[model samples]
Target: MPKTCFDPAASMASAALSESTLSGPTMGTRWAVRYQAPPDFDHGALSRDLALTVESVDAQMSPWKPESGLMRLNRSEPGQWVALPADLLGVLARAVQIGALSGGAYDAAIGDLVNAWGFGAVRDAPDPAAIRRAAASHRPAHLWLDIDGERARARKRMPMTLDLCGIAKGYAVDRMAQVMDRHGVAHALAGLDGELRACGARADGRPWAVALESPQEGRRAAHGVIELVDLSVATSGDYRHWIRVGSERLAHTMDGRRAAPVRNPVASVTVLAASCMDADAWATALLVAGPGEGPALAQRMGLDALFLLRCEGRLTEIGLGRFAAHPCRARIAAATPAP
Candidate 1:
């Protein structure tokens, strides 16, 4: 499906039963599946299949797993041709495309850089030289994929340390949705971490309402809510997954241009797209683009994004494209680009 622009008035929902929820753990986080189960559907078997699917994806892409496919590739020498599974290959391809389109803002090849920043399990700061070397290795520029053969190779001398942390969960959500579809289920809201995808509607005929969290630190309040059907939404924020590097606190999100986490004035970015993977990738890209360029870039790209910027100790929000129609829409911060 192509990317879509959300239209509130035009977006309606078809009714379906909402019953039987299943959830489990994956990729260091929890995944939930809320769906309308068919009468003949086996809830127990469906749950197992869903768990297995998520486990397979994690084994293929998780950097924390030493024996994972991505970690194996990372251990391989730069010139080595790694035989990638279809899932990893597809994610690499999409990551490369988004990285190129975002001018390296959405790079997946900065896995080593992330680890060096002590954002992984380690807490101490890494050597300065390692960080510099990691920054020099950009995924879109160096990772080569042979789509026809279903394998990929790295053209550079660095290891293939590609991290799918930003987008893998979204793909997992899509897979959950696929699983639900296969089992003759409908009206599902599948989510992993900060990404969510919804389809059809509840028995009451109302679309799923997703809450957007406020970007403030230590706050768990919802800033806005939007009704969505058959659409995926993802948000990237610096509020979580950050490490304090001496006096400076650095986020896990890395920017290839600076070879460091984005230092932009933006606090968070939420993107709505046809697919959860695209939404996840674009949310990171838009957050890295920051307030100055994000709104303009989002406008030009026809992307539906909601940006929360940190300005002078206060957070200001700006909505682009369809986000304007979101319920609880805040005052339009002046820095937002004109539509």
Candidate 2:
């Protein structure tokens, strides 16, 4: 493990959000907003504004929200074009772009399948035959968006549900960071549910230190740590949000191709990218790709990725060339003994 140091004095206050926060003992779970500007940067107000922006977008886009624009469109007759807000249109375009790049591993139109699997608003044991039928209607290609007019319409009569849970938070983080930057916040870190972006080093020029959580049970220490500046990191793992079906455990992440839970020994995969959306989608895609092919794909795409595998109660890490250059803090201590 390589040791990367972050200055505690410069660490910003973390805001609680949907995911658990384990970066620091007191951090807990929240949407953290840290900025390197005036002490009275109005982060609380900024967070509230960002949350409202997200909520408004959700109201217009989330299929789970019955009153959302998407649901309204779903209920409306065909040939009816629903006017979309600019924000919703932007996110929809991003979703389509990522879906195409990842080969549908990360899809926003899988709301029906997600609901069938009891992962969405409606929770029930889904029938295999029904699952296939629901999945057939969940293709992203069926979605049509006119960015200029901010309008969206589905070509098929099939009920189309859009769930932005996969990429929304990361996109929110980016938006919030923009807000901070506009306020002249030179050094800051915006993170929501482990998807984080570090704008720059602290005022003193110290890089931000981020730790990767161990995927194994009863392991409290970080698997690794990295010093970052102007970078974004996101992790996806089966350890969280999983259900046991018979003797096998299934993760919430589904392979759009097979319409089944990913069966891979890979415990977790973390990615560092230019944006959280890229990192978030790539993390899910790699998890679906499994261990062997996942790392290779990351390399082929010229991405920096770290893979952690659990074998016999221990964690083994495999890093691509780019990720390997970063030192693993935990490993360093094990190799060095006290005098």
Candidate 3:
């Protein structure tokens, strides 16, 4: 469940651009693409190119799409080699890198557990037995990616599902940004849902100001803010898409280690990475790791991260050293009193 928020107030110069919404299944959720390009940009032509990019990726990678190339491979009886798309192979390789670096805190094979806990395709409360089974099956190490001569194979016969929601959006954003850059749109922002990548300034000389949404339920105030330029930002939190199991509340974020919802003081984590995919994956990883380990990991990885924790019904900002330097002036001013 990813959401996007943009401050159109930040864009200055208005161009004659075409806008359209493209809806489809991505990252186990409905994806709505709101694309804007120059009016002369040829809506049909641009849509065709972008749609083909997305569809080609989905055909080879979507586990939900039964006839997808990945499904074909998953359903293969045994010891069968299914040729993989270059894009899928590239994504899997990066997933492996993140999984290893984060000590398995970030995983691509946690799909079954996510679904069992009412967080994926089937949104129903799962029984203890089902949870246990799903937990046991949530290991990225079990999956194999052998890129040999344009073919990739899963070495093990265990049931596996690859949900790339954590990283796919960022990758797509990056790809779209590249497309725009190639067309000489040096100053534009392209996003899918709120995972965004910005290029140059927004038709002006100022950087994009992103409001960090307060994690408080039903509240719309900015907890903080950050100015971004030529970078991507992704945030993950437990406040949305959660389930109540008895007296305890469970979030959609699953800890691959225990295959259960993470209980941490860190209510939300926002990461500034070179790519939205990296930011997204790191934000999830840090949130699961909790406040202490999260900040430490961010420091080690040289990431700009801000952690928000709810204390006594108030939001507190806890930033790694780097984040403090890039504070959102609006939020800081709001926190200050008039003399």
The candidate maximizing TM-score is 1
Off by over 4 Å in 1: 1-18, 38-41, 136-160, 325-339
Better of 2 and 3 by TM-score: 3
TM-score of 3: 0.81
Whole-model alpha-carbon lDDT for candidate 3? 0.67
Off by over 4 Å in 3: 1-39, 76-81, 142-159, 328-339
- Give the candidate order by descending lDDT: 1, 3, 2
Best of the two (1, 2) by lDDT: 1
lDDT of 1 by residue, 19-105 (tens): 778999998889988877545668998899899999999999898899887787778776667677888778877877887777677
Candidate 1, residue 324: lDDT: 76
**Deviation in Å, model 1, residue 217 alpha carbon:** 1.6
RMSD to true structure for each model, in Å: 5.3, 6.5, 6.1
Estimate candidate 2's RMSD in Å: 6.5
Per-model clash counts, in order, read 0, 13, 1
| Residue range 59-176, candidate 2, lDDT tens digits | 7766666777667655655445666556666766777776776666666666666777767665566567768778676555224422333234332244465666677767766776
